[model samples]
Target: MDILHTLNIASSMTATVFRGGAGIATHPAGAQPEMLLELYDFEGCPHCRLVREVLTELDLDARIYPCPKGGKLFRAKVLELGGKTQFPFLVDANTRTQMYEAADIIRYLYSTYAARQRPWYWRIIEIQRLLSIIAGLPRLGSGSRARPRSAGPPAHPLELYSFEANPFARPVRDVLCVLELPYILRSTGCPAWGASATDPAPGSRNRARLQARAGEISIPYLIDPNTSTQMKESADIIRYLLRTYGQTENGQTKK
Candidate 1:
């Protein structure tokens, strides 16, 4: 399918969810950490989506290990570390902390990294839960199934430039989740201010810089350092993943 078509589908899937990190609360000052935060989750999970939305609102970066159902690579890692398959599991190497549960994770993020005043929207935890579940309906079960084969894992984690509300990014993330490939999430949300100092629109400098570095502004962009392959478009990325990693000894995607 075309990129525009894919984006349209993604947008339709996440209609109720606010875009550009609206309504979510954020810290006035950025938090600097010694180590990158690690998360094990599937892109299609409502719970995981909540955490990622919060991450984007806070403008925090994370190392993601996709844990789609029937996945073999990171699923075992989640089991080893957390002793369960439950996700949105977070590990803070700097603080030596590992945690599960969406509500708890949200609270921890605010207290540890955000300003003292948390967003009122987040206070309505139940509402957030409901909305997240609603947002997840479009892509339900897309990332849960396992393929019959396996591609040997890469040496280094891949990198993805995306924001929570992006539809194209969602499908790419889903594929990664099912494949259990770990990656660095580079968020690219809209700017808070306009072009001028007095304007409120966020400037384009940051996004422009990222695009210049990557050679494109369109997201769900993937960079595989191990293979030195960087590309855009979700469908193409999915195809690449299947061709590279889909077949295992049993001729099935690893489950």
Candidate 2:
């Protein structure tokens, strides 16, 4: 990797540390929702990061609708659904519930799916939120706002195998968020404390699936069904996304 890219990954690692590695470990989930959960939030939102961490912890996959600031698309949908533009809005179609507030979302996910209560520190709402904000500072608002798109959204939602705190994965997610591309986030992380010591944790179904499908396990692995493309490497993914979807102000795809 180039020096600049290496530095970017280092900053992303710091974001994980600021949150004390919340998304690195997994917990058991009790029930699976019939339909995929939908999350309307920007990647750069501190509160959204908290919810994403819980998602990784519980290994729950969700369809992410990136609602970055100045985004013209999904932001309006959030307003129509929740009556305001406030985010980290979660729509659980199975339960017919749509709501905001990161703390409440974490509680609901744990209670409904994880079959347990949230971690103690997560219950300390204000303090946790404060720390999340600190964690997000290293990102320099990369995923907080929208960027131009060369074309409309793809017919099929892209698939991304990612864990919330994966430094290599974060930049890919940032580009997806900025372009407001909705994607199925397959939350993948270590199933236990030392799971990383093993190449693919025996307990990690996502990792197993990735290995079986791609012949290896690495993230953030992106599958763009729109173009029938699947690949690994964060920088390569970013470049492909820009070439395929991203646009400059003048409406040409960035090369």
TM-score of each: 0.82, 0.94
Misplaced by over 4 Å in model 1 are 1-29, 193-209, 248-255
lDDT tens digits, residues 163-255, model 2? Answer: 998999998999999999999998887777545523443345688788888888798999999999999999899889988999877888887
Q: At residue 244, give the lDDT of candidate 1.
A: 69
List where candidate 2 sits over 4 angstroms from the true fold.
Answer: 194-202
RMSD of each: 4.2, 2.0
Report model 1's TM-score to 2 decimal places. Answer: 0.82
* List of clashing residue pairs for candidate 2: none
* Model 1 accuracy (lDDT, Cα): 0.70
Candidate 1 per-residue C-alpha lDDT over 41-122 given as tens digits, one digit per residue, 9 for 90 to 100: 8876778877887776666678998877777778788789989989889998888889999888888888787666557877
Report how far residue 72 has shifted in candidate 2, in Å. 1.0
